[model samples]
Target: MTPRQPEGEALPGAGVLPEQTSAASSSGRERPFSVYLHVPYCRVRCGYCDFNTYTNLAMGGGASAGDYVDTLAGELRLARAAMDRAALPPRAPQTVFVGGGTPTMLPAGDLAGMLTLVRDTWGLAPGAEVTTEANPETVDERYLAALAKAGFTRVSFGMQSAVPHVLRTLDRTHTPARVPQVVAWAREAGLETSLDLIYGTPGETMDDWRRSLETAVEIGPDHLSAYALVIEEGTRMWAQVRRGELPLPTDDDEAAKYELADALLNRAGYEWYEISNWARPGHECVHNQAYWRDWDWWGAGPGAHSHLGDVRLWNTKHPVAWAGRVAAGRLPVAGHEILDAESRELERVMLGIRTREGLELAGLARLGPHGPEPTTAHGTPARLVPVVGRLVGEGLLEGAAAMAGRAVLTLRGRLMADTVTRGLID
Candidate 1:
C-alpha cells in the first residue's frame, strides 16, 4: 500500500541527497536507474484494493483514458525540468515498470506508445528490463505481441487465486482458466511472464491455496509473487470484515500459507529471492531489485513515488488534479523527503535483511546522521558484535555470513526478519 497523499512539498534541486551526483549513468557510475509509470484507470474497483486507482465510471469525465498518454508526456517533460532545476543530469533508465489499476486496460497501442515515449525521452540501457502489470482477462495474443514488439520484456499478471470462490471473495475479475492462456501468449510473444497471487483471503482454505499454487507453477511462469492479503482501512474489504460480513484469515492460517508457498515454489525450481517473491534462476524482477538494492528510480504518472539518492518524492494522486497541474506546466510532484543519514542507514538495514544477499555488516557500523563513526570490532561498530553474535546463536543469521561480515538470514530468520533487524538497528 502507498501513502494516500504526498507528505512534503516539491522542491527544485532541493531533493538531491548529500552523497549523490545529479547525473544518471551506467558503466561504473553508480546510480538509481529506473522509471515507473502509473496508470490509474480501472474497469471496476476490487473490494480489497486501496491503491490510488479509480474506476473509469467513478472518474466521471474528470480524466480521460485516451488523454492519459499525453498527460504522462506532460509529466515526463515536467520531470526533466524538475531534475534540471535540481541540477540532476539526464537519467536514462535501465528498468521501466508500468503498473496500474490494470495497465492493460488501456489500448494496446497506448501502452506501446508510453514505452516509446520513455525510449525517446531517456534512452533505455541495452538489455534493460521493461515490464507492465497485466490483468489476465484484459490481454489477448495480439495485445501481448504488440507490447513485446514495443520493447516490453516482461508482463506480470494479477492472478490472485485459482478457485472461483476465492476470486469472488477478492473481487478479481479473471477466471482461473484464463491464467495459463495469457502466460502462453506472453511466452509466445517472447515476454517473460510472472504470476502474482494473494493468500489468506477470507473463506480461502489450505487446499484452495495449494490448488492455486499448483496451477500457477504448472503454467510455467518465470516468476511468482504471493502476498498475504492486507485489508487496509477505508478499503471495501476492511469495511466488510469490520461489519462482520467477512472473516479475516487467522494468523496461523496465514503462516501456513506462506510456508506452503515457499515449499511448493522451491520444489518447482524457483528460488526465493525475497520473502514473497520467487523466480527461476535468471527471471527475477530487475525493477523490484532496484528498490531492494537501494537504487533510485523516478516514478512518473499520478500518485507515484520516486527516489533519487536519499530524496523520496511522490506525485499528486488524483488523475484530474494531476493532469490539470501537468497541463499548466507544473511538476505533478506533491511532496518529498530528503532522508537523513540515520534514516538512510536504518532503511538500508531494514530492506537489506529481507533479501537473499542480506545486509553487509559494514553497513551496520555507521552512526546516525551526523554522529561520530563508531569504533569497530569487525567491519561494523565494536558494540554491534555482541548483537550479531546473539542473533547468530539464535539461528536468525547465517553463521558463515556473520564471520564474513554479512547479515544473511537463516531459514528461521527469514520468517522473522524484522526481529533480527531490530536486534541490529534498535
Candidate 2:
C-alpha cells in the first residue's frame, strides 16, 4: 500500500494500464489490476491503532478464520461483477498484498488458502509479487516456510522500535531481540523480507531513534519503511497526549529523526524511492508501486477501498456489516465519488511530488502561462506559472527540472513536502 493509505486510511482513480494488460475477459481488457486483502484480526490492538480490526473473541457473527475466507471469496465474486460492469479486462493481478491487523495471527494454512482464492478467481500474473504483513512474534520457521510454499514471495514484519523503553512506551509486545530471529527465519524460508519502523513516539529520544535505525540496518532486510507517527484521534496514543501523560512529538523532532533515517539508510544501500520508504535495489514493494503509479485495483475486506478507472468506492467499516452486505449479494459499497479533471491533477501533484519520478508539468493546466496562451506551448498551464518560479527561487524545487517541465523536490523541499505540494495546487 502507498504510505498515504495507512491501515485505517483506505477509509479514503483510473489511469491507463502499462500496455501489458492483455488478459482475456469477456469484456476486452484495457488495464491491469491488483488485489489487496485486509485481514482485520489481530492478537492485540496496538496502542496507536484506529484501523478496523477485531480480536478473536470480539469478531462478531462468530467470524472464524474459515468463515472470513469464505466471505472474502464471496466478495471476490462481487469484485468480478463490478469489473464486468465497468468493462474492465480480466488481467491477472500483478501483485497481491495481504495487510492486517497482523495477518500472521491466523494460521499459516488460512493465509495460504486466501491466496488460493485469488489464484482460482483471477489467476496470478507470472512472477506476481505476493506479500503478507506479519507481527514479528507471530511467525516461526514452520509458519514462514508454509507461507513461502503457499506462493508468498515476501513478508514484512512490524518492528516499531529497537529500544525496549521505546517499545514499552508504544505498548509493543515483542522483544526487540526477536526481530533478527524472525528475519532470519523468513530468509531461510526463501521469502524476501521488509521491516516496518515508526519514529516520533512520545518518549523516544535521539539516541533511541538512532538505535532503532542501526538495529534495523544490521538485520539487512530488503526494504525499510520508517514512518512519522501520527496520533489518530481515537487511538490510545492520542488520548494519552490529550491527558498530558505523554509529550507530543514536535515538527523539529520529527524532521531530525527523518534526516537521520535518510542518511543512515542511504549509507546502508537503501534508496529513498518514495518519501517514507527506503528499499534496496530491485526490492521495492510491487504492490505499493501499483498504487503510487495509479493503476486499477480492487480492495477487499471491511472498510476496504477500491479504485477502478475514475470511480472510487469504499466498503462499510464494520466486519459484520460488510459480511452481511456481501452475503446479501450487494457490492458492500458504502459510498463512492468520481474524479473530475482538476481533482485528478490535484491528486497527480499530491502523489507525484512525493515520488522520485517527479510530477509532469504538461497535465497541470492550472499552472503555466495564461491570457490567450497558445495551445502549442510546452508548459503554459496558467495556474502553475507563478508558483513554479516562486518555489524554484525558494530552493524548494530543483530549478532545472522546473524549467524542463517537471517538479522534482529538492532536499529541503522533501522535508516540507506537504507545504510544497500545497503551493503548487493553490
Candidate 3:
C-alpha cells in the first residue's frame, strides 16, 4: 500500500547525503546502483489496489499518456543535474525496472523510448537487467518482441489468479488461458519471465489457490512472486469487507497458502530468494535486490521514491502536478528525509534479515556507540550473542548461519520476520 507522502521542501542537490562526498571518491563503486521508472496509467483500477495509478487517459496539464515519456525524460535530466550538483561521480545504472499501474498499458514504442532515454542520459551498465511489469491481456507476441529488441532482459506478468472466481474477486481482467500464451510469447522473444500471484482473495478456497500455483509452475517462468492480499484502508476491497459484502482474509488461511507455495515451488526447483520471491539458480530479480541491499537508485516518474546514501526522496503524486513541475525544469520532488544513524541501523537489520543471504553479524556488532570493535567468535558483539542464541534455539533463525556469523531465517522465521528483526534490533 502507498502511504501518505512525507512533507519536505524540494531543494537543490537535495539528493546528496553527507557521506556521499567521501564515498563517491573512494568506495562508491562497491555499492550496487539501479534505476526505476514508474508508469501511472492502467486500463482499469482494481478493487484491491491503493497504488498511485490513474485510469483516465487525459488528466489535463499535458499529462496524457501520449507525452508521458517526454515528461519522464525531463525528470531524468533533473535527476542527472541533482547528482552533478552534489558533485557525485557518474555511475551507470546496473539495473532498470519499469513498474506501474500496468506499464504494458503504454504503447511498446513508448516504453522502448523511455529505456532509450535512460541509456542516452546515463549509459546502462554492461549486462544491465532491464525489466517491466506487464498485464497479461495488454500485450501480444509482437509487443513482447519490441521490448526484447530494446535491450529489455525480463518481463514480469501480473497473473494474479488462474481461477475465474478469484480473479473476479480481485477485479483482475485476464483469463486463465492467456497466461501460458503470454509466457510462451515472452520465451519466444528471448525474454526471461516472472509470474506474480496474489493469495487469499476473499471467497477463494484452498483448492482454487492450489490451481493457481500449479498453473504458474506449469507455465515455467524463470521467477515467481506470490504476495498475500492486504486489504489496505481506502481501497475498494476494504470498503466491501467493512460493508459485509466480502470476508476479510484470515492470517491462518494466508499462512497455509504461503506454505503450499513454498513446498510446490521448491519441488519445482525454485528456491526462495526473498520472503515473497522464488527463482531458479541465478534468476533472482536484481532490480529488487537493489532495494533489499540498500543500494542507491534513481526512481523517476510520478510518486516514485529514490534512495541515495541516507536520503530518501519521493516525487509528486498527481500526474498533473508532477508534469507541471517538470515542464518548468524543476526536479519534481515533493519531499525527502535524511535518515539518522539509528533509523538507518534499524532499517539495515530490518531489510537484511528478510533475504536468504541473511544479515551480517559483523555489521550488527558496529551498532553500539564504541563502533567497529572486535567481535566474538561468532562475529557478533558479546552483548548480542545471547539474543542470537535465543532466536536460533527457538527455530526462528538458522543455527548454521548464526554460527557462521549471519542471521538467516528458517521457513517459520519467514512468517515471523518482524519478531526476528525486533530481537536483533532491540
User: What is the C-alpha local distance difference test score of candidate 1?
Assistant: 0.85
Cα deviation at 324, candidate 1, in Å, is: 0.3
lDDT of 1 by residue, 1-426 (tens): 333675674554332222343444323566758999999888878999989887762443335888888888888877765666667767689899999888998988999999988987788899999999999989999999999998999999999999999999998988889999999999999999999999999999999999999999999999999999989998888989999999988878988899899999999999988888999999999998999887778898879988886678788888888887888777777777777778877888888998888887876565568885775555767778889889999989999888888889876788788899889988
Candidate 1, run of 10 with poorest lDDT? 13-22
TM-score of each: 0.93, 0.89, 0.96
* lDDT, candidate 2, at 55: 75
Whole-model lDDT, model 3: 0.89
Against the reference, the lDDT scores of all candidates come to 0.85, 0.81, 0.89
- Which 10-residue window of candidate 2 scores lowest in summed lDDT? 9-18
Model 3 steric clash pairs: none
User: For residue 359, what is the lDDT in candidate 1?
Assistant: 88
Candidate 3 — which residues are off by over 4 angstroms? 1-3, 12-30, 367-374
Which of the numbered candidates is closest to the native, going by highest lDDT?
3
* Stretches of model 2 off by over 4 angstroms after superposition: 1-29, 57-62, 366-386
How accurate locally is residue 151 in candidate 1, as Cα lDDT from 0 to 100? 92
Q: What tens-digit string does per-residue lDDT give for candidate 3 at 111-211?
A: 99999999987899999999999999999999999999999999999998999999999999999999999999999999999999999999999999999
Cα-based lDDT at residue 357, candidate 2: 74
**Candidates in descending TM-score order:** 3, 1, 2
